[model samples]
Target chain A: MRFQLTEDQTALRRATRDLLERRFGERERRAAAGGGSLDRALWRTLGDAGFFALCLPERDGGVGLGFPEAVLVFEEAGRALLTGPLIATLRAAGEVPGAASGETVVAAADGWTVEWLAAADVARPDTADAVAVRSVDPLTPLHRVARAARVDPVAVLLTAAEQLGTAVRVCELAVQHARTREQFGRPIGAFQAVQHLCAGLLVRAETARAAVYAAAVTGARTDIAAARLLADEAAVDGARDCLQVHGGMGFTWESEVHLHLKRAWVRAGRGGGGAAAEEALAAALTA
Target chain B: MDLSHTPEDEEFRARLRAWLATALPVLPPPPDPADWPARRARDLGWQRALYDAGYGELHWDASPTTRLIFLEETEAAGAPYVGANFVGLLHAGPTIAAEGTDGQRRRWLPPILRGEEVWCQGFSEPGAGSDLASLRTRARRDGDHYVVDGSKIWTSHAEVADWCELLVRTDPDAPRHRGISWLAMPMDAPGVTVRPLRTLAGSAEFAEVFLDGVRIPVANRVGAENDGWRVTMVTLSFERGTAFVGEVVACRRVLRELAAAARRDGRWDDAVLRRRLGRLNAEFLALWRLTQWNVSEAAAGGGVPGVGGSVFKLRYSHARQDLYDAAADVLGPGALDLDSPWVLDRLSSLSYTIAAGTSQIQRTIVAERMLGLPRGR
Candidate 1:
């Protein structure tokens, strides 16, 4: 069995990365983050690009690709740090009337909180009495809602794919900073301490990548739970380590390192703060 | 990104499983771990069976996927491991196939594949463990032979091995890494001594060998005189990469057993305990996927593993340790009983981080080779 990406799959990933980087690259992302809301025009552009309809069947006027391909696209979105109801909108593609075409926005309730609820046309569980709350990640605004529902394994796997992407991106950032940033008459990467930190980040990221990719293929509940757990650990811990490699500069609002850590923190809390995945895995093991 | 096996792979798997169904039961009971002769015989008998079935050379001859299938099936069927034959089957045999001369391969490959001989490793010396390039096992050239003089520690199954894949310092003035040569030293040579080294688990599977003027033929050199380090790295990649495929399956089995015990003992009620077992389960499952990734990558890029092997090795070492730690939590007070299940496994888990390559060295490999980080000194 070949566990690596095929030529077409690799090309799809590269193409999706190129598309997202053009729209949500650092400059565009920062410019859009200042508003703290979803850009409808850009959202429609994503819909036109078939981002949301990636997994809808061809009979429904969509891309008809499977979860694996959608997972790849979402990974690129995560790497670009694209915010909004992306996961919710993507999950609602077949169910929500206009979601597949980007004419409608969908937001899924994550426990008692919903992200970008004010801009959403439909909420997954129809939360009422929503109140906007300050979020740690400036780009992702949250609205507290009176709805809590069990998340399906597919959503968990998709969220894990996003975390995998963040893990990989932060690992690259840490390695880059360690190489260029100097301390004690040399680059900090020359020190074993910094080097090991970056190495550990890479190890965690790669391990999570494998798990996420395998889970996408298998789609097993246990596999998805494991993937979620590993991807969360990798993304959260990797961003923290990436920040460590950047030293004082990473602490500034101007640098993108803290943004990644904040985003990772927010995402880790999305699928029940890792407790749900942990409990699911524990149940599987105990059975 | 297909993870499904090919039709041929599935067919081969089916045949191997059928063969093992009949083969494993008729075999005699396994000898004690400390029984060197008996263990050798049992292991060789299994190898001979594989040889007769045309699967003996799968390690080097077949595709990586096929080899993986063989390993998975054998482990699942409770077939014998390459216990006394690991150094030969996994390390030296593959290295020789990759770097040895045609003549050398014809001579050494047949006996090992046929289960007619066993090989032990002679790479780690007393003075050089992690810094293996500084090894001072002197092999002074004299006519057509090299007179080897030194001591090698942690030689596994040396008491039963017929050959030793040796590394020695052939040049004193060259660079530390450039002065070494690889030799195949006969274990029965004069002035060669083997003293079993007792492990913390109280097993003598490893030994220390003292060589005083043990002579080895020049024809036995696998590569150029000073190119042994590269060849040894090839052997080590095999050691770190595919050598542990069987153990992963075994670990999964042990994890299931641990989970069952947790349920039986009412420890499953503890969310913390259940969560620990669950996390270990995830860890092994991820490790298994990582193994598949590495093997698939190796299949694509020749038969040698890349830096990804180090990543897998670094994590798998700790995962095995964690699995046993959870096992102890499941066992409660019985963890200390020597005869209890997994007690020996728990004890042996301590060496996983130290053997093959230390976790420290693995981190260096990943940092420098994989991440492109600057090397420290």
Candidate 2:
């Protein structure tokens, strides 16, 4: 009945948070946004740290933990807004050479689009003839493709995991902003409108976190589908709300709040769009 | 991270499930919330059967997990759960268990468990619903008996209850919250009258109990004379616990039903309808997860359910209402027709928004209590 993370999981989260805070501070995050492709060195660092190997078997040169541990790490990665083809490489663990080691970078391509293809040493192509295309997120580039295969469920779940992270991160960002940013005379959080918004954001994040964690633990398709749906809603809507909390300052390019919204927008479309997840969920509910 | 119960829990669940499978068929279904006498008769019989088998409030020392399993399995099996004795079992019983003397416990606990007596709550009054401590229900100590004079409104099952967990303004001069006292008053005593009050859904599950100088024994006072507010809080905690597990289990089934109905009505193809259903379910799962986290947190700290009560209650109540609202939305014009099965559920579920505490009050609690926001002007 216990839902609290084990000591190992909590430590893993703390380590992941510390690493990203050290590596991708506000300065590095701004620098890494050159053409929306993550820095190769940072990508290498993630790979070398066994981030991709978390769920892969130990014999296959992976950490051999499981989805729960993987989710815990992914949540932190999400919180830090560390962007890259993390989900793709993690999915390709044990199957693709150098994926678990970060020696080779992996890019993802659906039928018409690919992410991080220009920098990728290897590509998990949903298409055979993938042509790189521009993506909405400047932090992650996209590529067009000729043909593509169905996305893996694990990859989909990982996207959800990332979305869950962003959802939680944006919630904290909003609350932090609300608590500190004064308006009219007091902290905006002291105002009912701002307080209610923060409350709503908290609700969205917690609800999505609950679903995502449960899905990560069970790996049930229905749970994952629901998780993906809620996490996307939470991340996207949460980002928008966070932006609103930040006011005109949040709308400016200098503010990191907009980056979270852009990131949420990208993650929401990845793995599979809302339509794909919705179909599975509707079937499960109707069945 | 394991959500599933232990082997021992599974065994309890299994035995309870087996018992329910056999016992439920023997007892008739509850008539309706409004039909107090008939529903109570059946609920009492069913409860006594469960109590005889060492179920119900008889298992006072059961772990939180075990209690949850019992609730989950009972809902899944559609077994009767002594709904007729809700106040007696869930609130009054728990309050007495926590605050009563040894002799008082011996006298009250067994009858509640055995279903020989039903209990009603006499807390809210005409002028004091949410601001319950401002209650004017006066109870004057008159030579070993307290003469109660004010009326209690929204008292559930007052007509059928043999006793009431009464809150009275024992000391009007004291501060509002500090002046109240908790009493176990005999409902059949002289000068006591019950008038049924039907809700918008046409169910008389509540009553306005008029207490005109009804005498209560001095020994029946729970805690001290002016400490009734604290005792009343214990009863409300039990009321809050009532929402923890059953609603999740039941709402899941309702979601499934709504989905099936949507499909049958050819509304499943509508993307908007599908998304609405999906979103409802996602929130429902969130509510379920939140409940689990709350339960586990309580278990870990050996604390009664605290924190996130308002948040959890507010979210889950709306989710329940949204479920029915969506069902009706998918059903269209038929949703308005009384003949349609969805209509009653849709119409009846609005109570969720208002019952226990209104959503606004819940928000205030969340704002002031959980979020640490200052109290409103």
Candidate 3:
């Protein structure tokens, strides 16, 4: 009846965090986003490290892991706010020729929008003339894509895992800010208002993390739907509360808080979004 | 992360289920809410049956997974819960097992497992609810006895309890938190009074216990003098940690029944309500999974839940409230009827945010203890 990470899984998670912290810290993330294009070198580096090919068979020139491991890596990527066609490329690892090696950057259409479409080497359901759109999140470049489809459940679950990661990251950011940021001669964390907000954020993130991890394990459609719904809430709401904790500093472009908020907003719309997930869940329950 | 039960655990579950199937039908019906003595007898009888069947002591003696299975299977089978014996079995007994002396264990633990005694919590006072450390219930030491003279509010089952796990300020001069002591007060002692306190739900299941110098033996002290606060925290950890396992299962059952009622009443056709129910279904499912995560985490780390229990409690308290709110939606005007069990549950749900620990306190604990946030004065 264990529901915690095994020693091996914990080591995998730590390694992923270390890699992201070293290669995709705030400075590097902003640097890669400055030109509004995918960083090819970093993408290749991640692929070489088996971030994309984590679930692929060792016989097929890949790391032979599973969804649980993939979820952990993506969670780290989400925390680092690593942007690009990461989810699509990872999904295409085994099927697309160069995706597993990061030689090809794949982008998939999500409703009317697609991320990094211009920088992608291949588009899954080739769109008819994508127009570049100004993205709310600086790290993620988007284009107005003309096609959309009901995404696979695995894609939905992975999107949720990313949201869970963002949720967790923002919670830590909120707690850190609350502890160090002072107001009226004491840490703002000493105040109940800010403390309650930070506490609620942790609760939401943790609840969503449980749902996301369980979705990865169970692979049930209902579980995935619930995970997506909760993860979206956690990420979106957690970022907003984190900004509240940081006060004026959080609103500045230099602070990473806004990036998390924008990314959460963007991710909330991905993989059929909250409305779709809710409807799926509603149908399941009603049926 | 494996969630499957071992074959041995599965056998235990199967045996329990079979025993319950045969055992439940022959038992007398449950007593009314107002019938304290009858309720006590019925509850203790169920406990005794479990004791005789070798399923007693599972709360502390069994592995966490097995305990979880016991809770899940029992709740699923519509079996009687610990009921009036909750404080003794879930709270005091565990505290005693964890912290009591060998003699304390020998004297107290078996009677609790055998369902021969009942205990009520005497922690909350009229002057000290959330700020329990500030309780002014005084206990003065004399020769071999402590003369307790104070009052405790919200002491559940005090009217029928054989014992009361009482907290009193033993040293008025020391720091508020440091001056306390935990003592097991005999409820039948002279100068003790129990005044039934009616809840908002119109039930007098709890009482205001006033002790006008009730004498307790020195041997009844669970832990050292001036260390009651820490001892009380131990009991509270149990309250927050695994106390809600069976309740989570019960909530899931209530959710299913609400959905079925909604369908019967044509409330299922409403998209908004259906979506709400669906969302709640997802919420409870996640909470159940959260319970699994917590229980497993506890099992891995010395069988005591860490701060994660606060996280579970915070969300779960609201979820339980939200669940009853959804039931009201299904019931519509039918919800106004006090006779409905759903209506009664909706009323009972109001206390969850206030009981065990308030949601406000839970947030503070999560922030200060779990997140390492600076504590507020």
Candidate 4:
């Protein structure tokens, strides 16, 4: 009957948000945006904090929380726009011992392909030793590293969760822009046209969040596709609206808005594009 | 985090199932609306049987937990009961129980439980669907009766319903919402007329019911005077929640058929359709889970689903529409050909979004109430 987060979940969310704010603030995000790769330090910090281990079994050196709690954490990650091989690491961490403790990183094989593994700290393709990382969104910390593994539904669900987070953040950024950006001496949010756009973005974000969280809790294949579809739409449309809200500044490299847009574009296409997700959804629905 | 039911509840489910095995009769699928009366009678018969077996009033305080268990089990067993008289069982029953005097409940409850009566909602008029308070239905007091005069549109099952749980303006001087009063009126009462309205699905399931100087007994009133809006809201909320689960399950069955068809035709290889189907499946699962969540919550004595129900309704309507659209796309030219049985059934799925409440209206509800956004108007 209630959708509110439990106290532990709320605290976890707040702590995660605070951690991201402290370690990967706007300046750090900007720095990472201009960087060669994602911030490994932040990834390590998350690993140490058991972020990757949230959904793992208790016996697996993890918190053993359910999808709902994982959703809270992922949402916080999205809000922070923290970039790293976080999803891949988390997915791998669940399968391998000490993976969540920064001892290992696993990468997925599909959607994004991993190449040039010599420089990677560990390269286990389709195995526990290898974390496959794909460059679906090169801007983010995702990679197609060689890893020995089977395609995990949990991984797909987690990736969708991360995408949902990114979409929500994009919507928040768009709303903030609409509220502050002035046109004709009034806040653009006051304009009906702008408000509608922001409102649509908000709907997309909220719906996607709801769908994704529901999927996490239910672990239903159809719910997963719904979460993915909403997340995809939110990320893609939210980014577009953010750009619209930012106007000219959004197109520039200096603007984080463009970065979000870029990441969204990459994520939407990654793991499988809109077409793939849509087709799967159609099948699931009819099924 | 433990979503499992208590052992006692599990045992209850089992015992109820055993009882239903003997008490419940197997029935055919829903007949075409063309055979409206026959189908309606059959449905009523089934409902009466259930009521006789003590499966009617699940949540009423007088109804024991055993009765609730039986009702839940019947639902879980996927036994077809009745269709389209939901306004009575879910809404009228509860409202009368909560607000009606003992005499009123005694009069109405037994007939409803016995399936001797069918009730349709008389809330939305042509002018007021979402802005329900703006309804122009007037029911002025006259002696021991109220002289009702106004028309209610989108009255589902009006032609077949024995009675109506109607909302009308009782006091002209009161505020729009405040002036409303809910009364149960017999469909065959003098000055009452029902005109069928056909939907795109080619079903005359709804009607425009006209009330011209219809004298309704004061004893039919359920809730306080000029507080009909509250009663109507409670009814609508129930409509938005529990009342729709069976329908959703039925829709899911249809969706399954469509999927099987797609698979048989080897259309699963179509990448575009596959992705679309996947997403639809996901949305359906989320909705199904939400429905289960609501049911379990109520079983545990949680509050009415409030904003959560609104969110579910909004998403569900859209998802239902999306499912139909996906089916149409997959069915290709066959989708448009209503002469084909498959196409007709697929086309029927389109009504899900528009029937209970339009998707647009549900979205407005979600935005205004759930998100606290400015009214779109």
Which numbered prediction scores highest in DockQ against the true structure? 1
Candidates' lDDT values, in order? 0.88, 0.79, 0.88, 0.69
Candidate 4 CAPRI-style tier: acceptable
Question: What fraction of correct interface contacts does each candidate retain?
Answer: 0.71, 0.44, 0.69, 0.31
When sorted by lDDT, best at the front, the candidate numbers are: 1, 3, 2, 4
| Local distance difference test, candidate 1 | 0.88
Task: Summarize candidate 2's per-residue lDDT along B29-101 as a digit string, tens digits.
Answer: 5586566688778878877887898885633447777777887888888775557688887788888898999
lDDT of 1 by residue, B171-219 (tens): 9899999999989888999989999999999989799999999989999
Tens-digit per-residue lDDT, B163-197, candidate 3: 99999999999989999999998899998999998
Tens digits of lDDT, candidate 4, B1-377: 23445577677677668877875456556676688787778777777876676656663442223333454466657776457557677777777777788998898888888878888888889998767789888998889999999999988778888889899999888879899999999999999999999877787768999999999998888888898888777766666766656556656665676777778888877776766666666566556656665555564554354555655676677777787787787788777788654566556666766666675666556545543444433
TM-score of every candidate:
0.98, 0.93, 0.97, 0.84
Extract clashing residue pairs from model 1.
none
Model 2 Cα lDDT, one tens digit per residue, A1-287: 77768888888989998999998888888887765555878878888888888888888778999888888888888878787778878877788888888877777774345777777778765445665556667777777666555667777677777888898788778777877777677777777777777677766777777788888878898888888888898899989998998999999988888888888887776654777777777677876
List all candidate RMSDs to the true structure.
1.3, 2.5, 1.5, 4.6
Which docking category, incorrect, acceptable, medium or high, applies to candidate 1? medium
Clash count list over all predictions:
0, 10, 0, 49
Best by lDDT: 1
Candidate 1, superposed: residue stretches over 4 Å from native: none
Superior candidate under TM-score, 1 versus 3 = 1
DockQ of 3: 0.71
Q: Pick the candidate with the highest TM-score.
A: 1
How much native contact recovery, as a fraction, does model 3 achieve? 0.69
* Chain B alone vs. reference chain B, TM-score for every model: 0.98, 0.95, 0.98, 0.89
On a 0 to 100 scale, what is the lDDT of residue B292 in model 4?
A: 60
Which residue runs of candidate 3 sit more than 4 Å off their true CA positions? Answer: A129-132, A145-147
Candidate 3 CA-lDDT value: 0.88
